[model samples]
Target: MTVQTWTFVIVGLTFALYILIAIWAKAASTKDFYVAGGGVSPLANGMATAADWMSAASFISMAGLISFMGYDGAVYLMGWTGGYVLLALLLAPYLRKFGKFTVPDFIGDRYYSNIARTVAVICAIIVSFTYVAGQMRGVGVVFARFLEVPVETGVYIGMIMVLFYATLGGMKGITYTQVAQYCILIFAFMVPAFFISFQLTGNMLPQLGFGGKVADGTYLLDKLDGLHRELGFAAYTEGSKSMIDVFAITLALMVGTAGLPHVIVRFFTVKKVSDARKSAGWALLFIAILYTTAPAIATFARTNLIQTVSEQPYASVPEWFSNWEETGLIVFEDKNDDGVIQYVGNQEKNELTIDRDIMVLANPEIANLPGWIIALVAAGGLAAALSTAAGLLLVISASISHDLIKKQIKPDISEKGELLWARIGSVLAVVVAGYFGINPPGFVAAVVALAFGLAAASFFPAIILGIFDKRMNKEGAVAGMVVGILLMLFYMMKFKLGLFGGGTKEEWWFGISPEGFGSIAMLINFIISFGISRFYPAPPEDVQEMVESIRYPRGAGAATHH
Candidate 1:
């Protein structure tokens, strides 16, 4: 069968499986909608969390980032995974012990103020919506390429799928469907990697293949290092960033991962504090599978891409090259009128811009793999993007309906009415996100970094202080969020938007890129929170007792009051 035909068959089967699972596990109540009735097994929750966490960024854009950034990409790998360690060790068990349905619930009760919860809801909406916009864009890209449809149409298709499961089954249905997505996405990711590894290094595992010798009997790392130097770029394995910048970016990602409300809420689905811990470990294990493979895929794809295009005439480049070129992802400037493509860095001060988002989707083609593999990869990318978009939309909906509308504005609202508002919130969230995806304000990867920074700055300190420090009050949480978010905005606009008469690296107030500025913002938030918290009288005595209650697993059953 042709590549298109096979892709339709495989992808169709996967979609059918998702619908069946959603139908089988449809949620029946608000509890079911919010926490999957808190009956999900640790293993199942781990799988669902893996799907929720990976997103389009992991499945589609990561390898591409590594392909060009080289060692700098390691920061993402280390930062994102290491954040999970923090979550498992310090946050997950305690949050689960607190036994609330959402992150805002914990903050609201722990601080003894509904206003604090309102701030959390606002922050969660911002973070989730920013992140989901990228996923929606990713869905559009995948559909346009593989399904042979316009990008907008692809996003609409994704929206319908998400609405079907997320609205009907709620968390219950979404969790089960996510498990299926995890399976399909992982298999699709690893199989092509294995084949490419064998073809390049005679190794079945891509990780070892990355470090192994290539066809010329030279280490791949050494070859890449040489190429980078020859092309006026930094060495492939060494970083050009200052130690402070590196530390800042890593810290931001760690705190940001711990702060993400969507990730935190997943622990609530597990039955016990211990189960939450186990689930975190399992989630990390699942994430590591993809994390480790991503760099290898980057190396393999970059090398193959250079070799394929370096000596070939631009006009005679393969059909695949032309197809991607049409998308404006891959460009060649035929400098010097040599006809042969030059893969070197710009020597004439003219740079060719290639979108990093294309690395994974274009990898199979670069390696001359069968067309079916390419199509399967496209489908897998859609699954990754859509699954994450759905999760983010749910968080956005819950923040507005559960936290804002019902909890704060109208506490007496009927449960049925609240659920209806939640669905409305979901639709609005999807529309806004779809619009942003179709017309992004900036680069996809850059927008993602901003979202992480915002989450790190505004939410991480509040959540951490709320759980660990009984003295933290509503004033502290609110002030911290306000200051942190404002600082992040100022820093981002300074460098990213050139709002302050254009930004220069040398003029950076602290030599931190906007990407790495979150750590400083988070630190400022923590310091301000602690300073003000010491002066303020402290949370109510009952709230202190709540903190104590959340510290142990024995009394967790009673932590849920409703």
Candidate 2:
């Protein structure tokens, strides 16, 4: 088949597969919709959670960012994967024992306050919405390439596709669909990495390829660093970011990963607290495969681009580079009228510009992989984007219908009415998320950046302390969430948007970037929450008993339909 034909075939088959799963696994009640009947196997839940995590950011952007940032990008590799350690140990099992359908449900019941639940619901919605927008943007990128349409139009297409599965099958549909997603995405990712590794370094293992000698006999990274300095760029093996900033960013991502509502909700779907713990182990194991291979891919892509394009005649540039040029992802300008592309660090001297986000998407074409492989990648990217979008939308809808409306505002709401409202809420969220995809904010470089910070600031502290600290009261939990999220929003708007005036990293508080500020903001949340408990009354006796019970490994049961 032709490239376009191949793309359509693969992409169509994947969508059909997801639709079939959604139809077969359609949710029957609120419990099924929210937590997949709370009986999913540990292995299945692990695969589902892995799919939720190996999102647009992981599949598309993380390796791409590392391509540009060199060792500075280690933050993402460590930060994201490290959070599961915190999750599996510090949070997931305990939350699973609490026997709630949602994170807000835990907060609400633990604090014994409707107001705390409301605050948690709002945080979940905001974070999930922010996260879904990024996924929509990823879908737009894939659709734009395959359908030959504007990215905006493609985003709307992606939104509608996710809306159907999410509304029809709810959590049950999303979980099984994600299992399929894990297979497709991981296969697509590994194939290209292996192919490129063999072509360049005679090593099928991308991990070994990074360390192995190339045809020229110099170490690959050494050659890359040499080429980088030759082009007036920093060494590829060394990081240029400040140490403190790296520390803060890594810390923020770690906590943020543990705190994200969509991820936390996955543990709730498993059959028991033991399953939650085992599922987390499985998740980290699977995630590590991709994580370990990414740095090698980043190194290879950077080296290949420098060697292939630097100082080459513009007229002689490869077909892949030209193709991306048409998409505006790669740009070349002959500033000196020499008709040659001088890709130096300085824009005045460099004749080519490449967007970092396109690194992974364009890698196959750069390596001259087969058409079917390229098409498979396009399908894989779509799966990564759509699966995560469906997961996030589920949490967004549940937060609005189940947590906010049914529990707080209309306690007497009918089951059918609440499920209907959940579907409606998903439509609204998808539409809003699509809008963000079309007209992205200048500062929203990666969806993971903003979403992680917001999650770290708002939910991480409240949930952690609520689980461990038996004395944590409603006032403290609510106050911490409100203060932390508002502070994060204030910083992001002030610095990222330049709302009041121009903002830059130079004006950052003690050199902390907005992404890293979440770590500090979370600290303030911990302090304020503990401080509030001193003046206010403690959690009720029964609420304290609930906290104590959550610490145990036994007695996990399926959450009933409200």
Candidate 3:
């Protein structure tokens, strides 16, 4: 069968499976809608969390960034995964034992302040919206290519599919559906990885193959580094980022990972604090399967891409080259009016430019793999994009329905009424997110990176301090979040978006990029929070006890809701 036929059959089969799971697991109450009845097993919760964590950026764009960023990309690999350790150790158990449906719920109850809760809700919505834009855009890209539709049409279709399941199942349906999605995404990711690993290095395992010898008896990393020099690129095994920059970037990502509301809410879906811990471990393990293999995929794709495209005549270039070029993902100028393609490593000077986001999705085509494998990739990319989008949209809906309407606007609203508003909120969020997907303000990678930075600046300090510091007052939490978010926004607007009349790296504070400014902003938040709290009277007696009680590892029972 042709690639299109395979894509249709495989994608259709996977979508059918997700819809079936959602139907079977439809939510019947607010509890079911919010936390999947809070009875999910550790293993199941882990799988769902993995699916939730690995967005389109993780599945489609990461390997591509690593392919080009070389060792500098370790910031992403380490910081993202490292944040999970912080979550499992620092926040997950405490939040689970607190036993609420959402992150803002914990903030409201712990700090004993409606204002603090409102701040958290604002931060959650902003962060989720920024992140969901990438997932929606990713859905559009895959559909545009595989389903042969306009990007706007693809995003609308994705919104429809997500709206169907998310509004109906809430967390209940999304949890089970995500379990299925994790299976499809991981299998799809690993298959091509294994195929390419075996073909390139005679090792079936991508993790081991990345460091092992290839056809010429040279180690893959060594060969990759060597080829990078010959091609005017930074060495694959060495990075140019300074030690301070790397440290700052990595820490920001770790804290941001621990702080994202969508991922944090997964802990509430489980049975106990122990389950939260175990589920985090399981989530990381599942995530590691793909994380460890990404560098290998990057190396393989980078090497294959250079070997196939560089110095080849335009007319003699491969079919995959022309295909991507037609999509404008790949472009050439024939700078000298020569027939040859001058594809350089530092792409700015080269006649050919290739979009890094296409690396994973186009890998199979570049290697001339079978149609089935290519089709599987399309399905996998969609699953990754959709699963994460569903989770983010849930957070958005829950914020408006549970936090805003029920808590702030109408305290006496019925649970059923709140659920209806939640569904309406989901539809609205999906529509706004789909519009951004069709017309992104920036590249998917850059947009999502800003989301992480925002989360790190705004939420990590507030949530962590609220739980760990007994004396931290509502005044301090509110002040810290506002300051943190403002700093990040200022830096991003100044550097990335070219607002405030624009700026450059030379003008950057301490030479740290906007992406790495979160670490600085977070530290400022911590300092300001503590400084302000010291001037005020201590937290109320009960609030101090609430903070102290959370320190213990025992007694995993749920907290009493107000």
- Give the clashing pairs for model 2: none
Q: Worst ten-residue run, lDDT, model 2?
A: 553-562
Put down candidate 3 lDDT per residue, 71-125, tens digits, no spaces.
9887899988898889888988888777788888888887788998999999999
Model 1, residue 230: distance off in Å is 3.9
- Residue-level lDDT of model 2, residues 230-343, one tens digit each, is 899878789887889999999999999889988989998887677788999998888998899899989888888888888888888898887677666677877899888889
Candidate 1 regions with alpha-carbon error over 4 angstroms: 333-338, 347-352, 555-562
lDDT for predicted candidate 3 compared with the true structure: 0.89
For each candidate, the alpha-carbon lDDT, in order, equals 0.83, 0.86, 0.89
lDDT of 1 by residue, 1-562 (tens): 7666877888888888888888998777778888899989989899889999888888998888888889888788878888889988988888887778888877777777888888888888888887888888888777776666777887788878787778878888888988888888898899899999999988999999999988889988888778777766667798778888888888888888888888888998987777888888888889899999999999998888767776577778887788777665567775678677666676574334577888898899888889778877987887788778878888988888888888889999988888888788888988898888887656566677778898999988988888778788889888999899889988888888888687889987677888888899999999999888888887888888877667655655433552
Q: Who is ahead in lDDT, 1 or 3?
A: 3
TM-score of each: 0.96, 0.97, 0.97
Supply every candidate's count of residue pairs whose N, Cα or C atoms clash at under 3 angstroms: 0, 0, 0
